[model samples]
Target: MLPPDFTLLQVVPELETGGAEQTTIDVARAVIDAGGKALVATRGGRMTARLEADGGRLAQMPVQSKNPLVMLGNAARLVDLIRNEGVSLVHARSRAPAFSALWAAQTTKTPFVATYHGVYKAGSGLKRWYNAVMTRGDLVIANSDYTRDHVLAEHHLDPDKVVAIPRGIDLDRFNPSWITPDRLSELRDSWGIAPDDPRTRFLLAGRLTRLKGHMTIIEAAARLKAQARNDFQILFVGDDQGRTGYGEELAKAVSDAGLADRISIVGHCDDMPAAYLLADIAILPTTVPESFGRAAVEPQAMGRPVIASNHGGTTETVAEGVTGWLVPPENAEAWAKAMERAIDIGAAKRTEMGLTGMNRTRQLYRVDAMCAATLAAYERVLDARRLTGKRP
Candidate 1:
């Protein structure tokens, strides 16, 4: 809960597809429902309509640009927005926009907040400095406990300033009972999966990128095929995001393995609930640590078991051998063995695991819970600011 007159401004790169974008929209809706005005500053995209539909205002700008000059210009623009809109606080969800948001918040004496959405890499000093802007917030929100720890260790910030609030999954959208037979059939038909085909279905849904470990999944599929385990269909459901070369490489790998029919690389699907409904198991074999794996929880919410890389946020979300198996990251053999176990475990056991996962996901990762915690965090920072005799 927040003040009825509170006006919160969230700055992000764009209203595009991803966990962060969805969270931004979710938080905006929460703010509006709580009797507060919500404004989002971004380079608008497809999700803008959804945000506006929720009664969230949009402040379009080139906040996605990484150019230093552009960031300074954005700060000036944000300063004007904050002052004119009577914004009570500024929250940033991405690094590039954060620098500008930080500058604007400081210049306007507005309480600032940020969400550590990813475990970013800093190979050099300059990069690390750039990443530190997220830590400059009055209060920093980490999407998972693992992420909170990583932020403290990486930035050496005061521990009290950082808090872990795991990303919430929309259970209503992912619920099995909410998905109709026709929705599943539509996705299956679009993906060219036959109605009567009896192969176990596996799905790996996310953007197609190198670190997402598309190669590792391909290798494991090949390993399964080598052992004459051909009664499985592994669907890679994600957009390449303009990585044409990697897409070609994955196609070639699938062709060379003689498993083209077994592995399908279908681009992004809007109906993820139907996509997960069509799968017996969901996979997330990211080579790197995920700050918090939203993908891992979505499948479980659909009453389906998951098999994700055993590291990062998944370690917290998935109960190994209970909800799903957590194989070693990037190890094709381990993944192959895990897949084999999942197949051999029988339908009853898999369904039992899925039910366990579904219960856990519902208890821990609801959208309303996340929003309540986030708004409470905002209240805390604003209270502190008021106590310090600062302008609100």
Candidate 2:
């Protein structure tokens, strides 16, 4: 055998610029780079442009619909797409699309894979069963060791079938040298912050959702009013993504805390590397466990002290005291304490820790490393199927 030529099909709700969306782009790019065909089948969105720009074909369909009738319709459509495109593998990034993709993959006799992006905390029995399909992937890609273990515990799947492949950031894109003070200053100009000011910027980047811990960060910042108020400014980045009501809640929390000025809701940052450079500290104060904390790693690679709540993959992302501090999840007081310590420990220790973080990022979380590992898993599954003379 020759290196098997695979027409990879990625099914997701929409091509939005979330972590899973970004990962889908990565996989498609890798497929083309590795001499395979990459075809993404999804309801097109903002990210669709970039997906096609990178030499991947986009097959648009109403994949976002979740109703049973809509899903079965989509499955029939996907089966047609797969058969016509000669897709050798089907990958679903969300549970909604997974229901359709699973049926399509089964019908087409293609390998099925799932990238478990978030921890689906089952609110009810039906929901739990619905989320359980994440465990049914021929190869389940978890973003972190924390997430891999969580999937094992919650879904009760074979550990061998679940693989930990953290979200990857291009080091060159996130490198400290790549973003300059001039660029950082330019972003500050837009944000109305003085370039010469010695004040620190504590940045939080994510959708303005309740689970993301914006209120918790604001509350913590308010509690720290007596300390680091002048030097530290909290900046929230990320568009509401239809969570305007939640944004209102955050605004109310900020107002109640009297941190209206100090806590800037800088929605949807465009230049994240520059945004990281503009910050003295980076934090992901999510209440629930993030399957993998993509927000934490970029700042670390940029040599910024990152403080994330001790939930989800944050424990794995931040090397505790080495990269930054990890406070108890949702504990505003504890977050306040950690923020104080991270700031008060002075710039020298911070620089040392930041360098350590950069080293860890360089060693472990390179995009190429992630791509290689992921491709290996795909090949393993394919080879097993080939030996058995069965379609995966």
How many clashes does each candidate structure show, in the order listed?
Answer: 0, 1
- Cα misplacement distance, residue 178 of candidate 1 (Å): 1.0
Candidate 1 — which residues are off by over 4 angstroms?
A: 390-392
At residue 11, give the lDDT of candidate 2: 91
Top of the candidates by TM-score: 1
Residues 158-180 of candidate 1 have per-residue lDDT tens digits of: 88989999999887888899989
What TM-score, computed on C-alpha atoms, does each candidate reach?
0.97, 0.95
Whole-model lDDT values for every prediction:
0.92, 0.85
Give the worst 10-residue stretch by lDDT in candidate 1: 383-392
Candidate 1 positional error at 197, Å = 1.2
With a 3 Å backbone cut-off (N, CA, C), the pairs that clash in candidate 1 are: none
Q: The CA-based lDDT of model 2 is what?
A: 0.85
Q: What digit string (tens of lDDT, one per residue) describes model 2 on residues 252-282?
A: 8888878877888878776888998888899
